[model samples]
Target: MLTPQWLDALRARITLSAVVGRSVRLQKAGREFRACCPFHDEKSPSFYINDAKGFYHCFGCQAHGDAIRWLTDHQGLAFMDAVKELAAEAGMELPAPDPRAAKSAERRASLSDVTEAAQRWFEDNLSAPIGTNAREYLAKRGISDASARAFGFGFAPDQRQTLKAALPFDEALLAEAGMRIAPEDGGEPYDRFRGRLMLPIHDARGRVIAFGGRTLAKDAGGAKYLNSPDTPLFDKGRTLYNLHRAAPAARKAGRIVVVEGYMDVIALAQAGLAEAVAPMGTALTEHQLELLWRQADCPILCFDGDAAGQRAAMKAIERALPILKPGLSLGIVRLPAGLDPDDLVRERGAAALEALLSRPQPLAEALWEFERDAGPISTPEAKAGLKARLLDHVGTIGHPDIRALYRRELLERFSALAFPPRYARVFGREARRGEQARTSAPAVIDRLQQLAKGGARDGFGLAVLSGLARHPGEISRHEEALIHLARAEPALGPAIDALLALSETLDSPAPSPISGAIGLPALPDRNLYAFLIEGNSPDLVREDLAEAVSLLVEKPALKAAKAAATARFDRDPEGSMAEQGRLRAREMALDERIKRLGRKRAASPRDDSSRSPSPGAMTAQATD
Candidate 1:
């Protein structure tokens, strides 16, 4: 009862060569491994293992299968046993046995039988005299006879009970397979499709699971394109049409193309672009996107250029952001206006589509452009809205590194857009500011030294300063926050200012004498928090530091909000009290977070100066 996705994951983890090489010695044959066929009697090697495709094949005996198949066929294990062995090897936990799910699987198998029978019957009808109109419709769409046959094109006759009468399956099974629809008032079932050119939708194993039909009659008073309802055998959201065929072609072509419909997939295939697939008449789903990623790192989405298509691409972008990994993403190709893959190939030829596919707009660029041009941005409010929209999209991204990068990049773009730079003037002004900050750093450091020597420091404030000193690179990253911190606690102003000025002057991230100059002890003394302790993970420390700074920034903002609510209490007592309550809850949460961060302090510094300088001493030591 294991799901296809789970089985696919197990196979993806287990290498075919590694499994086959256990039984037969395999030699490196370019990108694949080759060895003598274990399935047949042969002297020369004909068996080949392609780890890239996750399958092995033999030319001698024509025996072919994947890792699970290899275990079953060659190793003499049962199907479930083979899956269990591979799952154990792959460190995957087998799904607990569910009787209901088993029943569902059995039901789907029977429904698949119904769909398969219906497919054959439809194909026969297409070849018969009744299928002449469907054949002519294919011709007009530039679909060849061979391409139609390869795609298993068929037709449902313009009759109500044709499919039910032709197939030997029971009426209930036919209705369950979506080949027939049962009457609501409990009468006999009728054919679900009538007078439509049929294209069978398949599972990943190329088993006919459902059907999509396009009307052949021009004057038919019904929807032009209709897909089968979600049956036990078909979950349209999780299924991509033609993926079974397109996956192998995608590996060879190094890319996969996604179009709008099955017809577009066929047209692309006929145009020599066999590595194309389409969703089941819906926007791309998360499962389908993962299926595409399995074949290619960044499958190009070749959607049409009309408004609906553009919205589809945007929908895909929104869907993809939360699940995107380091290398796994989608590329987008927007076809010319008023043209789809089918029309484009028919009119301009396949090379036109190829040229467009060769250089697809990156997903990021597509997102930016779609949002940027979504509406007018002439006013300040409009521009701010655009920035907010971009940030909203960036915030959905799950990976922390990718989210930060996208935030930085999108905000930088927003800055460039909102306040277009005058490069020479701005550069000169920045250079002067940097030079002034540099010249004044020593004086500021001296002031910090005097203050640090005399004061009974606040422990949290000291930790924050020491944290910045230990990680000077973080100074620039949290510059604005530090400035706000300096404002909120004027006692730490000089030290924070000195760190800010020094951040501009330091050329490298190497430890400096800031800690010593600022009247703190050497590197070992600065381990006030676990984040600053030596041997801590760099990423963890950065995260902890970011949280600490964010809390520090939030403290003053919360205080100000509470003050405003108090001030308004005289005029709007009830509303202001509610606001006050909300702010008080936030203040408590902020305090709890600060306490949690403070609890990350280590026992004490280990007197390990040989390791590196403390935050206070970014460079070599300096005397007061």
Candidate 2:
């Protein structure tokens, strides 16, 4: 665990702008640097980096945090991954891991030793007299000795048990390193690879953790390429080859390209495209995609033009969709049929490969192309199928704004392609209904606000609405509770709906349209809502409003529990009594929380209003 002091020291050492500016284009904006928010879609810049404060905040998406948070959220790094990356950048050693983690760390260190020792063993075999065929294979592939050694290329001898004898490890250790196979009988373990060219797979820190081997022997029944199975230290699905080398170049180039195999990555590097990486033999996993996203927003995926390559690209697209965020997506490059990245570079030169990469297709466009060609769309059934496929892909995107836009773009193409204008006109009324719902949303909100003044329950419900209105940004934090409340009290449903709608557009600190929810009828005494809407310190009011909403949610939950406990009184007397006691204790705790919050409010200078919201405001609701 990183203590607060260590985190603070790390943050203080690393310039927030420097870290953020690598990925986002920042412009000077008075004291803070600004960029269009990476977390959401926006025309103008609303993401700000404050070097003075050592943090960044996206006013557009309400994504606010320090450097570590940026790494986790923006880079999709695991918490520890973010911390270690930052610590390394700041030149700080992490605090020692606790006992259990220390054990795991020691185990990994041992596994790494075995892999590294095996790497040396393979390199030795490469230059030995027996490695003549492997050297020939590299030469045939146009790989120079310099490039081969730079990538730590090696050869595994054809004889079995060769690695087992050379490496300083027992059979069990060798098997654990994925370097040896255990025989089914009560027999010895043998080397997994024979007559294969070897590539060392390194972790982000450039430590060898696994190996990928390709056949040097022709058409032997074995697979073309074999990777180390997942071991204590290596997971092919989570690992990317050449990342340790490509990351620095990727940061400089502001781009990263992902290819199908490690050979493709090495070929690109050899051809002067140093920013390419590839997943181990498996298709790109979410973990590997996150690794790619950390280096570039739109890494170009260069796949072969064959059926398998198209299938791989689509598979990657499906994997990427749900994790796609604004400003974070993929670009795709399809090599000509019967060609891969290596083939293209070899035949046409690096310039041709670069030219192909330059005009790569956007993921959305690729999606359209793939589905449009899935089948004939001349018939209505085929057209509907096309639309369904497009929507299915779009639905997988998790970000709200990005998802909406992808849907809009793809549906527009679908409408044009599948329906054309004549057929579109036939379904004009259906389309019109969608437009009407959108156009009428504001009127619905206005109507509901008017009705919010109709009854006592609504009056109280409107108080919750008003609180949310004053702190539009807090709507996201309390959205789940507000949604739950909507189900319980139908009177506040429309107001809750309006609050949510407004939250989506509350990208700026500009006056919220939903704040007009503060328009209240005259009451006998100024309640919490009245004071907060017109508070002197907007910050203070937002705090009080959050507490109020928490109470609003807790009240309904407590009532539901009480109802259940009372229902059980007849049959399960002792259980009901005990449950009732526990519920009462919880109610007392809730009362205390409200009192503490109210006291905090009371200590603050009051806004120019008739009264302040009571600290015990939740007590009345708890009993009722």
Identify the candidate with maximal TM-score.
1
Per-candidate TM-score against the hidden true structure: 0.63, 0.60
Off by over 4 Å in 2: 7-94, 421-624
Q: Candidate 1: where are CA atoms >4 Å away? A: 1-66, 69-102, 186-188, 422-624
Each prediction's whole-model lDDT (CA): 0.78, 0.76
Worst 10 residues of 2 by lDDT: 615-624
Per-residue lDDT, model 1, residue 590, is 77
- Model 2 / residue 245 / CA error / Å: 0.8
State in Å the error of residue 328, model 1: 1.6
Q: lDDT winner among the candidates?
A: 1
Model 1, span 513-552: residue lDDT tens: 3433344433333454554555565566677777777676
Q: What is the lDDT of residue 284 in candidate 2?
A: 91
